[model samples]
Target: MTTTPALETVGITKSYGSHSVLRGVDLAVPAGSVVALLGSNGAGKTTLVRILSTLLRADGGTASVNGHDVATQPGAVRESISLTGQFAAVDEVLTGRENLVLVAQLRHLEDPGGTADGLLARFGLSDAGSRRVATYSGGMRRRLDIAMSLIGDPPVLFLDEPTTGLDPQSRIEVWRTVRELAGRGTTVLLTTQYLDEAEQLADRIAILHEGRILTDGTLAELKQLLPPSRVEYVEKQPTLEDVFLALVGHDTTAT
Candidate 1:
């Protein structure tokens, strides 16, 4: 049997007056997989995501999340997905655990406290669960923000440049978290400008340019679009990240 896409959009169009933000965009994401919407700033990545998440209505075209139409069944669409924006949205005044508990309670889930505790441990935030969010590092705050998004266990996740301003180490931390989430079978639609991030996480990468999808394929497939480079051998050198991690005594391979 064929499986329907976990998320999909067809001819999705949006604009601000005459300045179009998205033009006839078509994309599909398979269940329990990660698809990166790769684009630079002003490429309409966020606009597409907002439309998919039902946060903004498209000027034209149809979109769906977990089988629910974004336009006709917006409530169901919203119920089936979670959105994490460019920056952490955690309440600085609340403790990490408190933030999770608040979302669980708002969702009317059973045993909110238990749910909070479980998520804290799941996100590796148990030790800091009692600390106010204001005290957490950028990575920790981002992690907690993501944990809160999981309260309802939405099957489709929309991450809009999740690691935008994070330092290298913190970016790696978020990368590890995304990998873990995908491993647990969540369908993720990640929008990012970082080519390395897409290479590291996406099963398939879709390049959006000038309000349209310019290309879509696996990394290997995309690379084929360019002529092969002449073979050469040189002494291997560590990247700056490698040197920095070494100086800091951090295990580059560690999650």
Candidate 2:
């Protein structure tokens, strides 16, 4: 028999005062796969993550994480999922190791120290484990936050723009880590404005616009939503640079 989806949201809607953020949004994430939520700013990506992580309630509709209703079974949902927000949630005053230990302890895990050590080593933060998080670089702090999120070994992870402000190398490192997590049977729901990131990591891609899913499918499928790719042959063909400038009015080669 097929296993149940790791996450599901049906007709989820949320409003703040007079403004509606999510308008009957629906999503499903299978275990051991990456589901990328792509959208422009204000498309409700963060709001959806908050609802799924049980940090906020949906104004209407229902959501479930690993078969537990988010509204009625929030504790069970929390037990099965972890969330890493756009900002690194590390405590700047605490050491990297201290942060992991604190998370493990809060999860009520036995041998929090051993767990912290293992995570530090896994995330390549072992050498800096004793240093205060304030001294770490952006990438290191992001890694530490992700490691802390894994203290409970959750079955599902919610990454909300986890690499928002990193350099290219650091972003690649985080991507590798995300792929590794999904490979280990952890379902991942990733939200990002980066189209390339979504294409690289998502098994399925969903684009949100105006608080609704405009389209959802595989990379090839999403590309199909755009005009068909054109092939041209020339002695000295226009490069992607020239094409980008012609279409989008940005000169990629200009300093």
Candidate 3:
């Protein structure tokens, strides 16, 4: 039996006046799987994400999350998903625990304090819970950010460049958390410039370029589409953008 996608889009289109940001994009993300969306700086990845998350409306075409139409049933879509953007949305003045509490209150979860404490411990921030977010390290703040997102236990999650500026170790921590989330059946749609992050965490990957998907498949399948690397090294090295160029071509790689 085929499962209905946790997230989906068809002929999705968007534009800013004369500039078209999206053009007839089609996508389907399976339930309980992690899918990574790869793209360059202005490839409209965020635009597509925002549309699915209800932060932005598509100019045309249809999109849905958890089977609810993004345009017409936006409230139902929002109720089933959570978004974690490039920057942490936490407040610096609030303690780590307080930050989670704020989100819990906003979400109307019962026992906001207890929910905060549970999330703190789950994210390994239990000891730092009382410390002001102003003093937390970047990784700590990110962990808290994700933990706060999880308080609602929404079935679908959108992580937009979540590891962008994190140190290597912290990036790994976030990657691990993402894996755990998927393992527990959360459907994750992650967009990132870090190719390795996608390779490491995503069960499938889609390349978004020129306002469209050039090709999408498992890592091994995508590699097969590209010609064998002519330049070999003592240590195999394929930069994320190298993979990007190989699969999607150079049209979208403009600096």
On the 0 to 100 scale, the lDDT of residue 90 in model 1 is 94
Residue-by-residue lDDT tens digits, candidate 3, 8-90: 99999999999998998899999999999999999999999999999999999999899999999999999999999999999
- What does candidate 2's lDDT look like per residue over 95-212, in tens digits? 9999999989998999999999999888888889999999987778888889999988999899999989885556766887888787788899999999889989999999888888
Candidate 1 versus the native: TM-score? 0.95
Model 1, span 1-255: residue lDDT tens: 014689888999999999999999999888898999998899999999989988899999999889999999999988998999999999999999999999999999999999999999898888889999998888888888889999889998989999999878788888998999999999999999899999999988999999999998889999999999788999999999788867876532322
Candidate that scores best on lDDT: 1
- True lDDT of residue 98, candidate 1: 94
Q: Cα RMSD to native, each candidate?
A: 2.1, 6.1, 7.7
User: Who is ahead in lDDT, 2 or 3?
Assistant: 3
Q: What TM-score do all the candidates reach, one by one?
A: 0.95, 0.88, 0.89
Ranking by lDDT: 1, 3, 2
Off by over 4 Å in 3: 228-255
Clashes of each: 0, 0, 0
- Name the regions of candidate 2 deviating beyond 4 angstroms: 1-3, 233-255
Worst 10 residues of 2 by lDDT: 246-255
Better of 1 and 2 by TM-score: 1
